[model samples]
Target chain A: MLKSRIIPCLDVNEGRVVKGVKFQNLRDAGDPVELSFHYQDQGADELVLLDVTATRQERIAMLETIERVRQRLSIPLTVGGGIGSIEDAGRLLNAGADKVSINSAAVRNPDLIAAMSARFGAQCTVVAIDAKKQGEIFQVLTRSGTTAEAIDAVAWAARAESLGAGEILLTSFDRDGTRSGYDLPMLSAVTDACSLPVIASGGADSVAHMVEAFQHGAHAVLAASIFHDANMTVGEVKQQLTDAGIQVRNEW
Target chain B: MIQIINTGVANIRSLQAAFDRLGCTWNLTVSPEDIATASHVVLPGVGAFAAAAEAIDQLGLRTAIIDRINHRESATLCICLGMQLLCESSEESQSAKGLGIIPMAITRFGDGVKIPQLGWNEVRPLDNGPYDAGEAYFANSYRLETAPDGWGAAETDYGGTFISSIWRGRTLACQFHPELSGTWGESVLTQWIEGITC
Candidate 1:
C-alpha cells in the first residue's frame, strides 16, 4: 500500500523564507536549504517552496535557492508561485525541482495544464487550486485568493484531471491559516470528482486533523503554520498517524 | 568515474546533486567517448519513452551504452524511462523500438488500477541485490508484467506485482527515481556506485 505523505510548505518572498519558521535548531529562518535539510531530518515526505513574490528577479533567485536546496537533500522538491507559462515551469524543473505547481496561471489558461503535461509529463505538473466556499458552492479563487471565479471547485478538479494533470493540491481559502481543521466537505467533493491524487492543504491544527484529511480521501496533507511555527514536528505527526492505523514512511 | 548520459528528456542536475551530497564525483556527458571511458554509467530519463529512445539513438548513445554493458566491465544503471528503453518495446509509443537489452515489453496499468501509480510503494528484493525490502518513491503510468527471468532483483505491487528493478550481469535498471526517493534512494545509489567502483 502507498503511504500517506506529509509535506511542509515554505513561503519564499524575495529569496528568503517568510512567515518566520521557528525550529529550535534552526537559527536562520530565511535559509531555505538549511530549513529543508532540517525538515528532511524530521522526516518530511516532500517539500514545497512557493515564491510568494515571484517577480522577474525573484524567479532567478528562487531558481538559485532551488538548486541549493536540491543539492542538500534527496527528497522530492516541489516549486510553485507565479508559474504562469510552460517556460516558467521549465525553468523550475531545470533548476532541480521534481514537480512544479501552478495555480493562478492554470486558472487563467486551463489549456496550460495540458501543454505542461504534454511537455513535462503529468507526473511533473501539479495543478494547485485555491478554493473558497461561496454561498452554497465552493468557488475557485485566483490571485492569492482575492479574485473569485464562477468555476465550481469539483468540476474544475475533474477538468484539470481530464486535461492531464497528475495531481491536485487543493487549498481551502476559507480554512487557510485557521488552524481549525481541513474543509472535509470541499475535500470530499473534489476527491469524489476526480481519480487523481489529491493533496489537502490549509487548516491543519493537530494530528487528528491530518487523519481526518486522509479519511476524507486526501493522498497527502500539507501544512504551513503548525510546522513552520515549530508547534509540532513531522515525526510526531507521522507517529500519530501511524498510531491511528495509517501507513506512513518510517525513515524518520 | 561515473558518467550520467544526457538524453535531453529530463534534467540530470538532481542526479548530480545526489552524487554531490554523497561526496562522489560524476560527469554529465552526451559524448560516447566519455561513456566508453567511465567505470559506471547512469542513464536517467523522464517524459515519453519514444522521445527518450529517439534522443538516445539520435545522440548515438544507444550503441555506446550497449557496447559498454555488453563488452566492457562498466556497470550501467538505467532509471525510469531509461529502464523502459532497455525493454523490447512499449505500448506508450508504438512506432518506437526499445534497445532490447532485456527481452520484455512494457505496458500500461490495466483497468481498476490508477494510471500513474504515484507516491511511495514497497519494493521487495527477490534476489541478493543491494536493495532491501523497503519503500521507495515511484511515479509512473506503466510497468512490466514480470521480471526478465533471472534478472528480477526487486518486485513491487501496485495493481499487481511487477518488476521494479532488474539486475543482469553488470547492467542495472529501476522504474523508480532513486535521486528523488530520499535517504533510502541515496543509500541504494551509493551501494550501486560502490559495487561498480570496488
Candidate 2:
C-alpha cells in the first residue's frame, strides 16, 4: 500500500526562502537548499518550492537553487509558480524538479495542462487550484488569489484530471494562513469529485487537522506556516498520523 | 570514467549531480564510441518506452550497449524506465523492444490500484544482498513480473510485491530513482561505484 505524504511548502523569492523558517540548528534560514534539507531530515515525505519571484532573472536563480537543493536531498521536489508553457515546465524539470505545478496559467489556458502531461508524462504535471467560496459556489482564483474566475472549483478539478493532470494541489483562499484547520467541506468536495490524488493545502493548524484532511480523502497534506514558524515538526506530524492509524513513510 | 547514456528523453543533470557529490567522474553521451570505451555505463531514461527505444536505436547505442554489457565486464546501471528497457519488452507501448539482457516482461499495475505508483515505499533486499532494506522513492505505473535468477533482486510492496532492484554480473538496474532517493540512495550509488572500481 502507498503511504500518505506529508509535504512542507517553501516560498522562494529571488532564490531565497521567504517568511524565514525558525529552526534551532539552521545556520541560514534564507537559503532554500539548507531549509529543504532541514525539512527532509525532519521526515518530510516531499518538498514543494514555489518560485514566488516569477521574473526572468529570478526564474534562473530559482533553477540554481533547485540544482543546489537537488544535490543535497533525495526526496521528491515539486516546483511551481509562473509555469505558463511547456518550455517553462521543461526548464524546471531539467533543473532537477521531480514535478512541476501549474496554477494561474492553467486556469487561463486549460490546454497547458494537456501539453505538459503529453510532453513530460502525467505524473510530472500537477494542477494547483486556489478556490474561494462565494455565496453558494466556489470560484477559482488566479494571479495569486487577486483575480477570481467564474469556473466552478469542483468541475475544474475533474476537468484538469481528464486533461491528464496526475495530481491536484487544492488550496482554500478562505482558510489560507488562518490556522483554524483545513476547509473540510471544500476539500472533501474536490477529492470526491476526482479520482486523482488531491493534496490539501492552505489551512493546517495542528496534527489533528492533517489527520482530518486525510480522512477527508487527501492523499497528501501540505503546510507552510505551521512548519515555518516551528509550531510543529515534521516528525511530530508523522508520529501523530501513525498513531491515528495512517500509514506514512517512516524515516526514523 | 562513467558514461551516462542520454536518450534525449529527460535530463541527466540530477544523476550527474549525484555522481559529483560522490566525487566520481562522469559524462553524458549519446555516441557509441564513448559508451564502448567507458568502464561503467549508466542509462537514465524517462518518457515513453517506444520513444526511448526509438531514440536508442537511432543513436546506434542499442547494439553498442548490448555488446558491452554482454561481451565485456563493464558495469552497467539502468534507472527507472532505463531499467524497464533492460527487459525483453514493455507493455507501455507495443512494438517497443528492450535490450533483452534480462529475460523479463514489464506490465502496468492494472485496475484496483492507482496507475502511477508514486511516492516512497519500503524496499527489502533479497538473498543476502549487500545493502539493508530501506525506504526508497518510486514513480512508475509498470513493473516486472520477476527478476532473472542469479540476480540479487530487491522487492518492494505496493499492491503486491514487485522487483525494485536487481544485480547480476556487472549489470544493475532499479525501478526507483536512487539518485533522487536522498542519503540512502546516494549510499547505494556509492556502493555500486565502489564495486566497479575496487
Candidate 3:
C-alpha cells in the first residue's frame, strides 16, 4: 500500500535553522544542513525547509543554505517562503530541492501553480495553504498565518488541484503550536474537495495525533515542535501509525 | 553527450543535479537539434498522464525522442512519470498516450492504497535483473500495470501487485525517483550511464 509519510519541517532564517515557541521569538536550532541530516537519520520520511527570511539578501542566503542541505540529505526536501515565479521554482529545484512549496505567492498568482506544474512537473510543486478557522469556513491566511484572507481553504485547494498542484500542504493556524491535535474538520474539507494528496501540518501533539491525521484523510502528516522538543521520534511516530493500522515505512 | 528530453514533467532539476553530483555531463533538451546529437537520452517527468503526454506533443519531442531511441538504440532512462510514458497508455487520463516502447498499460492503485504513492519503497530484483533490490523513492498516483516489453528487470509492491523497475533494454525505466532515491538510486543511475557509455 502507499505508505503515509511523516515529514519534519525546518524553519530557516538567514541560513540557520530556527525554532520558535508558538511561531514567535525564534531561537537558533542549529545549522540547517546538520539539523536536516539529523532528522534524516532519525527516520524522517522528508524534510521541509521553509526559508522564513523573505528579503533579497536572505534569499541568496537561503539558496546557499539549500545547496548545503541538498548536498547533505538524500531524502526529499521542500523549500517555501518567497517563491514567486516558475524561474524561481526552477532555480530551487536545480539547487536540489525535491519540491518547491508556495503559500503567499500561490494565493497572489494562482496561475503560477499551473505554470510551475507544467515546467517542473506537478509532483514537485506543492501549494501550501495556511488557514485559520473562521466560523464555518477555514479562511486562508498568508504571511506565515498572521493575515487571514477571505479565501476558502477547501475551494482554494480544489482550484490548486485543478491547476495541477501535485499535493496540498494544509496547515491550521488555529491549532498550530497548540498541540491540540490536527484540525480534522478542516482537513476533511480539503480532502473532500480535492483528489490530490494532502499533507496535514500544525497541532501535532503526540503519536496519536499523527495517526489521527492519516485517519482524518491526510496522506502525510507534518510536525515541528513535538519533534524539535524531542517529545517523540519519527521512528516512534511511524511505529505508532503502524500500530494503528496505517501503512508506514518501517526501514528508515 | 546525454540529453534529458524535457517533456515538461517535474523532477528534471533533480535528475540534472544528480548528474552533476555524479560528474556526468548532460543537458535538458526537448528540441530535435539537441536530440539529434545526443549520444544517450533520458526521459524524466513527474505528473499525471494527460499533462505529460500533452507536454511531449506540445514540445514536438515525440518524434525526436522516438527517432533517437529507435535508431541509435540510445540508452534511455525514464524516471517516475517518464517511466509511465514508456508504456502504451495510462488510466490517469484517457487521452494520455505513452511512447509504447514498453508493452505495458498504466493503471491506478486500488482503494486500498492512497492516490499518490508517496515516500520510500523497496525494489525487489528478479533473477538476472538490472540491479538488486534496494530502497527507491516514489510519488505517483498511477502505475504501469503490465510488465515491460523485452526486459522485466525489477519490481516493487505498493499494495497488491508488483510494479516494473529496471525494465532494461535500449529503453529503461523505473517508477521510483532514482535522483531522490538516495545512494542506491544514484548507483542505478551510474549503472545506467555506464551501460549506455559502454
Each model's C-alpha lDDT?
0.87, 0.86, 0.79
Q: After best superposition, candidate 1 residue A157: deviation in angstroms?
A: 1.1
Taking all chains together, the TM-score of candidate 2 against the true structure is: 0.94
Q: Would candidate 3 be rated incorrect, acceptable, medium or high by CAPRI criteria?
A: acceptable
TM-score for chain A in each prediction: 0.98, 0.98, 0.94
lDDT of 2 by residue, A130-238 (tens): 9999987789999999998999999999999899888899999999999988889989899878877889998898989999999998889999988999988899889
Estimate, for each residue in B77-195, the C-alpha lDDT of model 3 and write its tens digit: 77887877877788877767887766668888778664567677778776465666787778777876655545656767777766757554555678888887767778888888777
Off by over 4 Å in 2: A135-137, B196-198
Question: Going through the candidates in order, what is chain B's TM-score?
Answer: 0.94, 0.93, 0.89
Kindly list the per-residue Cα lDDT of model 3 for residues A18-73, writing each as its tens digit.
88523222243477777777777777878999888868888888888888888767
Give a tens-digit lDDT track for model 1, residues A1-252: 778999999998877889878877777877998999989999999899988984688778888999999999788888989998999899899999989999989988999999998888988889999999988889999999889998999999999999999889999998998989999999999998898889999899999999999999999999988888888889989988999998898878
Best by DockQ: 1
Clashing pairs in model 3, backbone N/Cα/C closer than 3 A: A1-B158, A1-B159, A120-B10, A121-B10
Deviating ranges (above 4 Å) for candidate 1: B196-198
Error of 1 at B89 (Å): 1.3
Assess the local accuracy of residue A25 in candidate 1 as a C-alpha lDDT between 0 and 100: 79
